[model samples]
Target: MTEILVVGASIAGQTLAYWLARHGMRATLVERAPRLRTGGNGVDLRDEATEVAARMGILPRVRAAAADVRGMKFVDAADRAVARVNMSRNGEIEIMRGDLVGLLHEVAEPEVEYVFGDSVRSMEEDAGGVTVSFEGGTTRRFDLVVGADGLHSSVRRLAFGPEEGALRHMGHYFAFANADSALGEDRWVTMYNLPGKMAGLYRSGNHAQAKAYFIFRSAPLAHDHRDAEQHRTLLKEAFGHETSWRVRELLDGALADPDFYFDALSQVHLPSWSSGRVALVGDAAYCASPASGAGAELAVVGAYRLAEELAGTSDHQIAFRRYEEGHRELVKRKQQIGPNVRMMVPKTHLGMWARNGLALSMGLLARSS
Candidate 1:
C-alpha cells in the first residue's frame, strides 16, 4: 500500500482525500487549524463541479446547506438596485464555503485519518519514501505528498519555493466577515459599488448572521496575510473614507468581528505542480482568483482528476504530469479574469457608470429571454 500525505483540510484537500479513500487508499490529511473552520462566504458549483458533487452523492446535502441567494444585485451608493445577476438561469448552486467544506469532510474524514492543530515543518524526499517533520513534534514517512492547500500553501513553499515569486497580484484586494443580521436582506446579495471599490451584504434564508463583503482596487499594500487584527485595521483604513450608504455600518461590524478575511485577489501560476514525490492540486497549483467565481468548481474537479491520474498508475511522476496536463488549460481559461474585475469594481467614474448600464442591459435581456 502506498502511503500518501495530503496537506490542507480545505474543500480541495477533503475532496481529494475522499476520492483517494474511495479508491482504497487511506491518505493522512493535516490541517494547521485546530479544528474544521466554519462560516465563510458562499461559493458556487458549476458545470463539472455539480457533476462531481452528484457522483459523490453529496449534491443534495450541498443544496440543503446552500445559501440559496436569489442573485447578486448591484446597487448604487444611494441604495437603488442597478443590476441583478441571473444565477437561477445558470442551473448552478451557491453554498456557503463552510457548508461545502463540512459536507466534503463528512464524506472524507471517516475514510482518511485526519490530524488537526499541526502542520508540516519540513519535508525531504529519498528513494524509499518522503520524510516529513511536523510542527507538533512528530515525523512521518509517506510514498507521495499532495498539496491541496489554498493560495498560501505551506507544502508548495516547502516543496517548490517561496510564495513571493509565485503569486501574481490581480490588481485588487478583498475582505469579508460575518455581520449583524439586522443589516441583511433575506435571501439576497446587495452589492454597492464606488470608484474602484465595492461593499455588499449577504444573508442566506437559512442563517441568522449576514456576511459583509468589501473589495477595492489597489496596487498592493504591506501587511501580514495571517494577522486577523492587521486585516481588520487595513479594512477599516480602506473603507474609512467612504460616505456611501451602509458602507460605514458594514465596516463597523467588520472591524469588531474577528472572523475577518483579508487578502489580495491573486493567483498562483507555477511552472509545474510537482517536484519528485510531491505535487500540488487546486489553488496551490492554479488559483483563478475569486473574481472568476470558479474556485470551488476548479478545486473539487481538479482534485477528482488528480486522484484519477494517481489511481491510473503506481508511479507518482506520471500521475502528476497527467494531472497537470489535464488541468492546466482550465486554469488558464479561468485566470483570464477580464471584465469580471471591472464588473465588481470599476476603475473610474465612467467605467462605473458603463458597468451599471451594462448590468441594466443584462437584466433587461434576462427578463426578455
Candidate 2:
C-alpha cells in the first residue's frame, strides 16, 4: 500500500482524496483551520469538472446547493439598473464556495483521515520518502506529499521557492463579506461601477444574508493578507473619492464582517508543479486569479487528472510530469487576465460607459434566447 499526505482540505484536496481513494489509494488531509471552513462567496462549476462531480456521485447535491442567484444587474450611482448579466447564460450552475466544500468533505470523509487546526511547518525529502513537520509538534513520513493548498501554499514554498516573482498581480483588488440581504433584491446581484472601482451586493433566494463586494484598480500596496482591519482601511482609502451606489454601506458591512476576505487580484504562474517526492495542485500551482471563473473547475479537474496519472504508476515523478503536460495549456489560457481585468474595473468613466453598453447587449441576447 502507498501512503500519501495531502495538505489543505479545500476543494482541491477533497477532490484529490476522493479520486485517490477510488484509484486504490487513501490519504491523510491537514487543514490549518480549526475545522471545516464555511465562509466564502459564490463559486461556479463548469467544463470537464462537471463530469468529475457526476462520477464522484455529488453532482445532484451540488445542483441542489445552487445559490439560486438569477444574475448581476449593473446599476448606476442612483440605484437604477443600467444592464444585467444573466447568471444562467453560460450553462453552468453557481454554488456558494462553502457549500461546495462541505459537500466534497461529506463525500470524502469516510475514506480519508482529517487533521484539523494544524498545518505543515517544514518538509524534508529523502530516497525513502518525504518527512513533514507540523506546527503542532509532530513529524510523519509518506511516500508522497501533495500541496492541494491555495495560492500561498506552504508545500510549494518548501518544495519550490518563494512566491514573490511567481505571482502576477493584476493591478486590482477585490473583497467580499456578509451583508444585509435587504440591501439587495432577492435572487439578484446588484453592481455599480464607477471608473476604476466596482461595488456590488449578491443576494440569493436560498440565503438569508447577502454578500457585499468591492473592487478597485491600483498598483501593489504594502499590506498583510491576513489582517482584516488593514484591508478595510486600504479599501476606505481607495474608495474615498466615490460617494455612489452604497459604497459607504458596503464598506460598513465589510468591516463588521468577521469572515471578510480581501486580497489583491493575482494569479500563480510557476514553471513546474513538482519537485522530488512532493508536488502541488490547484491554486498553489496555477491559480486563474478568481477573475477567470475557473478556480473550482481547475481545482477539481487537476486533482482528478493527477489521480488518474498516479493510479497507473508507482513513479510519482512521471505522474507529476504527465499531470503537468496534460493541464498546463489550460492553465496558461486561464492566467491571461488583461481582458478580464479591463472588464472587471474599467480604467476610465468613458470605459465604464462602454462596459454598460456591452452589458446591455449581453442582456438583450439573453432575453432574446
Candidate 3:
C-alpha cells in the first residue's frame, strides 16, 4: 500500500484523497484548522468541472446545495439598481464554499485518515520515501507528499523553496464573513462599487444568514494571516468612513463574526509545481485569482487529473509532468483574464459609471440572446 500525505484539507486535498484511496492508495489528510471551516460565500461549478462532479457522483448534492440565486444586481450608493444579470442561465451552479467543502469531507472521510489542528513543519525526501515533521512535534514517512494548501502553502515553502514565484497582487484585498441579513433581500446578490472599492451582500437560500464581501485597493498590509484582530482593524481603517449603505453596520458585524476571512486578491505564478517526490495542486500551484471566478472549478478538475495521472504512472516524474501538461492550458486561459480586474473593480467615479453602462448593455444583450 502506497502511503500518501496530503497537506491542507480544503476541497482539493479532500477530493484528491478520495480518488487516491479509490485507486488502492492509502492517504492521510492533515489540516491546520481544528474543524471544518464553514460559512463562506458562494462559489460556482462551471465548465468541465461540472462533468467532473457528475462523475464523482456529487452533482446532485452539489446542485441541491446551490445558492439558487436568480440574478446579481449592481447598485449605486443610494441603493438603486444600475444593472442586473440573470445568473440562472450562466451554465454554472453556485454553492457556498463551506457547504461544498463539507460535502467533499463527508465523502472522503471513510476512505482517508484525517489529522486536524496540525500542519507539516518540515519535510525531507529520500530515496525510499518522504519524511515530514509536524508542528505538533511528530514525524511520519509517506511514499508521496502533496501540497493542496492554498496560496500560502507551508508544504510548498518547505518542499519547493521559499516562494520564488511572483505573487501578483491585483491592487486589492477582499474580506468576507457571515452576518445578519438586515438588507432584507434573498435570491439575489447586491453589489456596490466605488472608486477602487467594492462592497456586496449575498443571502444564502437555505439560511437566513448572509455573507458580506469587502474589497479595496491599497498597498499590502503587514499582518499575520491568522490574526483576525489585525484584519478587522485594516478593514475598518480602509472603509470605516465610506457612506455606502449599511457599510459601518456590516463592518461591525463582520469584525464581530468569529470566522472572518481576509486576504489580498493575488495570483500565484510558479515556473513549476513540483520539485521531486512532492507536488502542489489548486491555489498552491496556479491560482488564477478569485477575480477570474474559476478557482473552485480549477481546484476540482486539477485534483481529479492529478490523481488520475499518478495512478496511471509508476514514475512520479512522469506523472507530475503529465499533470502539468494536461492542466497548464486551463491555467493559462484562466490567468489571461487577470487583466480584466480593472474593469471588474473600477478605480474612479467615471470608471464606475462606464462599468455600470457596460453591465447594463451586457444585461440587455444577454436577455436578447
Winner on lDDT between 1 and 2 is: 1
Report the lDDT tens digits of candidate 1 across residue range 1-369: 878999999989999999998887879999999999876788889888899999999999987887877767776667777666755647688888998998998888789999999999999999988999999999999999999889999999999999998899988999888887787668888888878888999988787889999999888788888998888878878899887789998998888876788899999989999999999988898998888888988999999998999999988889989998998888888888778887778888898778777767665412212
Query: Which stretch of 10 consecutive residues in model 2 shows the poorest summed lDDT?
Result: 360-369
Candidate 1: lDDT of 113? 95
TM-score of each: 0.95, 0.95, 0.95
Tell me the whole-model lDDT of each prediction, alpha carbons only. 0.87, 0.86, 0.84
In the range 94-113, model 3's lDDT, one tens digit per residue, is: 88888889989888999999
Please identify which of the two predictions, 1 or 3, would achieve the higher lDDT against the true structure.
1
| TM-score, cand. 1 | 0.95
Stretches of candidate 1 above 4 Å error? Answer: 362-369
* RMSD of each candidate relative to the true structure: 2.1, 2.1, 2.2
Check candidate 2 and list the clashing pairs: none
Give the clashing residue pairs of candidate 3, or none. Answer: none
Q: Candidate 2 local accuracy as lDDT?
A: 0.86
Give the local distance difference test score of model 1: 0.87
- Candidate number of the best lDDT: 1
